[model samples]
Target: MPKTQPTIRDVAAAAGVAVSTVSKYINGTQRFSGSVEAKLKAAIDALGYRSNPLARSMITGKTRTIGLAILDIRNPHFTNIVKGANRVALQHDYTLLLVDTEESQERERPLIEALAQRVDGMIISSRMPDDAVQWLLELSKPVVLFGRSQQFPIASVGTDGHLAASMLARHLLNLGHRRIAYLGFAKSRWNDERRRGIADCLQKAGLQLDVHDAEAPSAIAGERACSAILLGSSQPDAVICYNDLIALGFMKEARELGFRLPQDLSVVGFDNVSYAEYASPALTTVDLQSEKMGELAMTKLIAALNGSHDDEYAMLEPRLVVRESTMRRPDTSQPAGVTEMTPKTAGGRRRTGGQGA
Candidate 1:
């Protein structure tokens, strides 16, 4: 007789279970009892049954896959969000496909269109404005946004950028950071809110907020942006970064140029990425619950796919993690700029450098 390949039906029969139960367990779509699980495992081992996801998906009318779009995977914060989303996807026996738009809005539409055809749903860290969200809503697949927008109508999970920055600003104000500078990207989606929060807080304290721009969200960009600020005449007593990656970069450059952490300049940052704790002075940052946000986005997306998604937005509050990076502003005001790094350009500007609804 010819050799026969073991099928899902064969395993089901061996385990005295329904074929659907066997299939569901194999696909990780649902959990099972211990006894049933043991039987299923034994049956699969004995029969050498192999699952064909494609065939199973075809019959069930589900691809069992999700697509995730991020502005830039290079950012450590986004990397942690990916980690969080992946955990939820695995728990549900689904696969995740990740793509980056390189922080370009032009690249987003094409990525979304291409990914829409391959997956049941999507989660995005969208960087565009209202029109973009409207366009995404019209797509075939369900969507969950990872950040905020005044115009977002679709479901989103986000930490309150404005509130988070406000909290940091208040903390700094309490610590007496009058000459504080903001370090961040100019084109970021959350830039307006983040700036508003800090600016408002500063205004309340009768101080003007100094804004410095970074062209990109990378560490190297941070180093370049901070270089000008560190060398400029109007050096701030403290600097608040857009995110931990940029903050870490600024810290590295500052230390290299002989600026003592929290002594010469107090520094604060957003998005408490893993490296924040391990940093030389241990970064003081906002914990945005990045992984939890990712998990929530994925969970909501799955629910939406199953016709159980709520239209309400899920907002997460960021917690401040005070480490060695931030301290009381030094008694001597007008902290000295690092003259040894480089000379500033003739221009007065920096030379080199949220949630869905």
Candidate 2:
């Protein structure tokens, strides 16, 4: 007769525990006492027991894996989020497959469809449309949103973009900045969420939204948009950027225009990325808790897999990080490139006030 493979049942028998106890331990469903946990581990090792999670999932109509759909992998903010999600997923023995839509929602749909076939669930961190999310819901698979929340019953885990934007705008407004411009790539749906946040603040204060366009979500794009704003007839006293890259780009261009940082134009950036602090003037930004958002999404996804949570959403708070990049409207200011700046610090390391510098 062929030898039988050591299964979870054998491990449970050896450990003197119910099969359900072993299952809970393996799937991260419930915690066990220290001694019991140790004995269970020993029993599994002694019996050479191995869990075929994939096979078991197959039997149960699950894949035991989750898919992550994101936009612009090059952005540091997104990168941090991926790291956080990966970390949390590993703890629960879950695997993550990432998909970058190249900032294109059209590509997002097909990619999500392809991935949904292989993974048990998905987390979308892109500019996906409501209709697309509804479509995913109809597919009968667990889906979660990373940044934006859907109107339907799918899960959402992210920072409060609107509140963050309002905080940034309010900071500038409090600094006596009357002419403020918001620069971003508004073509994408995700950007719209951020825009609405800033718009809410501006409207509340009886101020109009001065919007500008960017080529992309990079430093180069930020430079172009900021340059345009500088050349425009109505020069803004401050500019609220979509992200750190755009804000850095604007600062670079502002310098070329013989403008001094914070003296002539105070700039505020979102997503408090690493480079925010190392720039010539340092950058003031909103900390979106990207990593925490990722961690939360992973936790939620894992919980869903273990039947812990139904379809619930999680939202994290965003805090503002004030740094050297912004200060009271400069009393004495000049156009960009009027004065040369000193070389950056050693190792070219930018100071991270604490989190995203």
Candidate 3:
């Protein structure tokens, strides 16, 4: 005869609790007192009992799983977002189905189709354009967007990019940096909104925000983009990057090309990623509170799953973090040969002051 699998009922019996109590505990739907919890743990451990998600989900008509689709898991910012989502999902007796889209729009459709079939709902950090609403509307499940917004008015949670861009530009402008450059692609909503903010600040100062092109959001692309611009005569004193990864790349390549950081070229980056602070000169980037945004996004998605939320959007706050990588625009003079700068001030930051609203 086949050996019987240890059931929730068996564990309940061993723990001297009602079957309902065990169910609640396993589902993370209720809390138990210390003594009761301890007894249940011991019973389950001794019996080697495991809750079958499939069996439980079948009875409830809910897979109790959420999908998290990101552009790339290799980026530190996305990793933090995933970490935050996982934290909330675990507390609700749920797990995530992670999808790395590799930043490819061609692969997004297939991945979404597969994920929708298995998950109750999804949270996507989509890199696709806003006009791709038809595909989003066709999904079988609800989706909460992270860091990216679309024209479809789907539920989203992210930083206010316009306000963030204004803050970044204001910092550079206040430090007397003229000919500040922005590095990123503008086809996405995130880029367009930020571009508007950068333009707003620059126009007020009677200066133009130089738009530079990057092959991708990675450091390698940043390096290459900066190199291309260096070949030109008009060089920006400060460059606002799409993210820390790009900023790090541009900085690395700039130093290799014999330019000293902050002394000759000040760099500003978005996303205060983990390695941003530990980079060579430490990155001065925007703190979008990415983890908090992810937590809020997951909470909103879960609430939507429970039919408790409207299809509304939530915008988090943004702020600037000053570090060693940026400073007041210096002499704008090239070093005779590897010249080092001695500045009057160290690192500092300014408050964003208000939201994009």
Q: Candidate 3, residues 39-137: lDDT per residue as tens digits? A: 999999999999998977875668989999988898888999999999999988778999999888789879988988899999988777777755766
Using TM-score as the measure, the top candidate is 3
* lDDT (C-alpha, whole model) for all candidates: 0.81, 0.77, 0.81
- Residue-level lDDT of model 2, residues 192-246, one tens digit each, is 7788877776676677888887878889998777667988899988888888988
TM-score for every candidate vs. truth?
A: 0.81, 0.77, 0.83
* Model 3 lDDT-worst window of ten: 335-344
TM-score of 3: 0.83
Q: Candidate 3's error at 348, in angstroms?
A: 10
Candidate 1 lDDT score relative to the true structure: 0.81
Q: Return whichever of 1 and 3 wins on TM-score.
A: 3
List ranges where model 3 is wrong by over 4 Å: 1-3, 8-48, 147-150, 330-357
Per the 3 Å backbone cut-off, how many clashing residue pairs does candidate 3 have? 0
Superior by TM-score: candidate 2 or candidate 3: 3
